[model samples]
Target: MTKADLIESVYLKTGFSKKESAEIVELVFDLIKTTLEKGEKIKIAGFGNFVVKEKDSRRGRNPQTGDEIEISSRRILTFKPSQVLKGAINDSNA
Candidate 1:
């Protein structure tokens, strides 16, 4: 589902207007992004962990021209779902 869908769900569950729901969802996303930008991790109970991982520069090959290239170092955000979330996803009722 998209962000709009998520905002709608929040609106339905909390009896908030569409605009307020969108703001709430946006605020949550902004908080997550800001936290990740600070090189920190967020762990939500029964949901998952959001981690920022760092990778060193590396050599990579171009698939088309077969030329070697230098891949720049970067930080990546990753998520690992909690066991409960995984179970919920695999549940038949879902």
Candidate 2:
């Protein structure tokens, strides 16, 4: 869902004003962004883990021109869902 949708959901659940809901949603997202920017991990029980990993530079081929190129290493964010979340999703699909 989009940010607006999330804000709406929070407002409905918390009985907060629209402005307050938006602020709450924005605050949560800002916290996540800042934590990730610091190369830290966030773990939410029964939800998932957010981690930042570093990768080494490597050689890669240019798919369009078939030219060899160097790829610079960078930090990447990854998410691993909790077992409980996985089970819930799988159960719903089944």
In TM-score terms, which candidate is top?
Answer: 2
Which candidate leads the pack in lDDT? 2
Each model's TM-score, in the order given? 0.93, 0.97
lDDT of 2 by residue, 21-53 (tens): 999999999999999999999999999999999
lDDT of each: 0.97, 0.98
Per-residue error (Å), model 1, residue 53: 0.5
Per-candidate Cα RMSD to the true structure, in Å, reads 1.4, 0.6
- Displacement of the residue 21 alpha carbon in candidate 1, Å: 1.1
In candidate 1, which residue ranges exceed 4 Å CA deviation? none
lDDT accuracy of residue 52 in candidate 2: 99
Q: What's the true lDDT of residue 37 in model 1? A: 98
Model 2 misplacement above 4 A: none
